[model samples]
Target chain A: MSLRERYGGMTRAEQGVSLFVCGFTALLVVALLTGGLTPSYTLYLAGLTGMYVLLSLGLNAQWGYTGLINFSVAAFFGLGAYGAALVTASNSPLAIPGGVLVGLVLAVVGSAVVATAIAIPTLRLRADYLAIASLGLAEVVRQIVLNQRDWTNGSGGLRGIPDVFAGWPVLGPLPGELPGLQFAEYAVGIPGLFRIRVLGFTLGEPFWTDLLNFVAVVVFVAAVYLLLRRVHRSPWGRVLRTIRSDEELASALGKDTYAFKLQSFVLGSVVMALGGVFYAYLVAYVDPGDLEPINTFYVWIAVILGGSGSNRGAMFGGFVVVAIREGTRFASDILPARLPVDVPVLVDVYGAIVSDFGSTRLLIVGLLIVLVMRLRPEGVLPPQRELLWPSALEETDE
Target chain B: MALLELLANGLVFSSIIVLASIGLSLVYSIADFANFAHGDTMAVGAYAALLAFGVIGGVGPTVLALPVGFFLSLAVGGAVAALVAVITHVLVYEPLEVDSIGLLITSIGVAFVYRAIIQLRFGSNPVEFGIPLQRPIDALVPLGIRITVHEIAIVASAAILVVGLHLLLQYTDLGRKMRATADNPSLARVAGIRTRRIEWWTWIIGAGLAGVGGGFLGLYNQLSPRMGFDILLVVFAAVILGGIGSVYGAMAGGLLIGVINQLMPAISNVAVALPLVPNVGPAYADTVAFLIMVAVLLVRPSGIAGGETT
Candidate 1:
């Protein structure tokens, strides 16, 4: 059946849920643009969340769509960030052409390379073994990044990397070369109007960068969403579902399940790499500490919370998770300072508590995952189809 | 003389590792999940021992602290284990009953929660207790490796615990029940064994042993929040090497890992002439353990004792 025909057959409830999701997303974007809820401090937080959403979607593509549990998303993301940072840095060979293109290529290629290296020995192993191996590999990658001071600058981290949109053309040339006209003079021309007249185009530096990043991220996400949607509706997607449902049966049907799984893994890893590039540009820094195992688990939580097999759900999950994290930070700021001691001791104690809470966000996230798993196994927005049951008993019963 | 001293010191270090690994192995075998919090359980035990030492003020408080620490840690560990079991069952394992993989991930979460709480309480700094033994050894025996009384105690205590555990598992009714449950949970349940209760007890005992190990380690090294994770690799390596379900294997494996960890540095130092091999020195012992784990897994995925479903 054609994609439209198949979608048309979906229940009204599903359609309603999709519509609500779209509405919520639109509302969030509008709020962000209009400065409704998020303030200056939280703008960075929102951007970070957007980056995570992108990463989570990549994970969902693998785990949610293909039933391949990747415990190394953080590593791939870090690699991408590092890749972009290294390439775009003033010292690197591929510093020109905006670094975005270079970063993208490097991330994709690097992810594929790492995936292939890991999959050769591990892909044939059992699921549990794969999990352990992937976790170990991630650690290995992290340690390598930490120890390789020459390449990654070791644990000291890579700083002073140029912003992706730093040197981009924000405004066009000025109309008629207004001689001796300062920026202040142009500023006073309009009240409540923040614009610079340059080459017939009026825009601010911050505005332009923000606009560029937003558009770039949206386009990337949209393209991925479309591609995933197409794949989900295709025969290839059906095969993937079959493999996830019953690997033996799919293999019996002459489907190279291992190859398909590897492809999914590599593809997802590549997408995560791109997310990492965005993250690097957003933060303007890349550090080994930023890419911890907990980060990968956070993405897992996001994808699962959103609805594993649903691309849109993964995106939504990312947004919610990031929002909650930022919201917690904002909440912490508003909280009354309650200390049991006085002066220096009080400051020390309060600071310790605050930092402890900050670090323990992962612990809370873990607890949330547990709650979500127990309460909603199918996730917030489960896949449209009932995927394969692993056992023969389940198959016959169904 | 210095070399002899280093060897003695290494042996002492190995003994502590062996104790820690044995406890971890028992838990892995019986509990069927790697308790990432196993290390913290050790830290908790060490702190408990420190508390005991503080309470019983005397010249020989360190020596006396052992039993107090052991018993206190046992109590604390057992209680915590039982609590974790119930919480895990309710929150993580129950929901994804069919998915063992999900349970594994949940265990990781549970481990993180335990770790965070510990970090929150302890503040990530290393807590040290003053050593009671001043003179490491007497001059009576010639060519003897001078060792601290505390180190001596650690070795002696580890031996006693290992033997005690071996005897307990082999001889007692509770031990037999535990074995039955570990062997076949469903079958044991059908055969009138309270498998859940058995599992609870297993956690308690396992965690308690870890606590005891931790207490001893506290005496040997410093107690930090990351101490558990730091030693986790070595412990797991030992467990896997010894055999997943076999207590004896764990003990042997622990001892073996301990020896390798201690000796590798000496060997590396001696090979300073080798251009390619930089002397890893004492600082990178954890790195050595990590490498060993990778090697073991690559060489033998079934582990030394083989996989125990329980």
Candidate 2:
């Protein structure tokens, strides 16, 4: 059977595998919780992973699905985070919700405007130039943001922003106490058995912010996944795929490729911006340093790892990639202090030799990308469809 | 006097930029890929020069160090560039069969690898040349224009290199081969030209020039791991503005950008003097080159000289 046919035939098995994976993941989480893992650290990692996944999905929408090369995803994300920070930092209550809404709106509008403006002059240029131009534009945005002290507070950064769910209690169900879910008081039975207090209202600590952020991310991802999946199966999606496969053919058929690309750019940018806004709320601070070009590549790695064109793949990619990064740090922290002398020396020497290795994660990431492109270009979770999608669709086509 | 000083400073800066950009433009034009590691190659040159100076020892050692530094830098840069070109071609570009966009992304990865290695060795700190030059020229020149001997040497070397490159490209058989390879690699190959050899030569020449530029820059402004990366954007802007693939254009673009960047802030008061608008001072001049680049890009996507799109 053909590869496509084989893949299609495995749908039921794939579902079962996914179920098993989910179960296994839950079991692992439970084990960690019971095994005395730092709750705050775990929560923080979960929130970060969720954010990365959101970003990866956004990028996948543009790059994998639409075949649009977006080198400025991080810039959009940064813009949203900064926008959220600016709004939340304001004393006005209207600014809080308004800030998030405004952040998302501006991110979409601004990215669209920039994309449109650039496309007019550069769309005809070779694709590579477009990539360069986009990269340059991202840098320009970063510099502008950095230079605009009056608005962005410059590089010193904006701090002490009000959290979206600040007044909410930690380790509790939503604001209202739900019936049939009693707060379990902490009790130790056998080594593995433990009960924790939940329900009602216990503020506990600031950890609730992270939990809320994770929930927010999950909801957002679900909504986007459903929306994108629908679009991917639509007639417009077919046209987008055609455009990706052959732009000239798409344009020959009277489709305006420029308009389609602009739409995709705007939509992907908006999603990234939303992720940024959520990230700001999670961190409670926004800084220029947080929005480096490296962040864009990180998202790229996630998308590529998961499966570029697949929404599910993007989510998986983001989670796995973030987990690896955060898990490495945790490993470093928790690893045994005393090893064989020779081994310790080797580790120390290697660490010193690759002192910039941490920052050089991009290099590692690049190598991984190269390896993926070579060995498994389809990625770990290949998209269901063979055809690539165009970034834009005519309103009539839709 | 201050105006003259600024002009002189701008000229010196422009010379350095031109030296750096021309090599970048050549590599991009010929290889059809942006060597993201180009900046690090420059850093390598600076470090090589430092090593040479350290080995030679004494006041006169710097004078002797220039050629040794330049040649060593050229060798190192060429070797690294060629190795990376081959590796990238095999690992990244060939597999994807994607266009230069994919290659460029891969180049970013390669650049980081080179940067990490450099940082591993150099510890990311700035290193000074610390060569004390005689002040006869500085004292003799009017307008408080203090052009050190090192600066003079840099200017002289840059002029020589530019002229030499122009001649080689215009008059040499190798230059013709490179041009042919750049214009149509398949056609060149069909004509029995060894495209791979031409590419190797192109990388060697281009990277060598970058190395020299880096070494000179190290002399002028402290040698740091980031120095090359920081200046890379400006160099790229110069390359694009001048028109990609045009060496002369790159040089001209570099000098024009450098001068405009310096002169704009000086003339900021002119805008204020003309109308009701208040003067924006020199603080924003740092962004002048980038603004010009953006404006130029908007106006002419193919660039000022109108060669390649990027």
Best TM-score among the predictions, by candidate number: 2
> Residue A328 of candidate 1: its Cα lDDT?
62
lDDT of 2 at A331: 54
lDDT of 2: 0.68
Model 2 chain B worst lDDT run, 10 consecutive residues? B57-66
Cand. 1 Cα-lDDT: 0.68
Per-model tally of clashing residue pairs: 7, 5
TM-score of 2: 0.83
Q: lDDT per prediction?
A: 0.68, 0.68
Docking class of 1: acceptable
Model 1: lDDT of residue A22: 70
- Tens digits of per-residue lDDT, candidate 2, B1-310, equal 4667668768878888897888788778877876566776677666666666565534333442344444444345434544554555555555665466556766666666666666666677888766654463646476567666666677777888889887887789888888788778899999999987887677667766777787778877888877777777778778778987777778889998877766765678677788876455675564557666766766775577776422
In the range A22-128, model 1's lDDT, one tens digit per residue, is 77667666554443443333346556767887798789878886788788888999989888887776544334455567767887788779888877666665665
Candidate 2 at residue B53, lDDT? 59
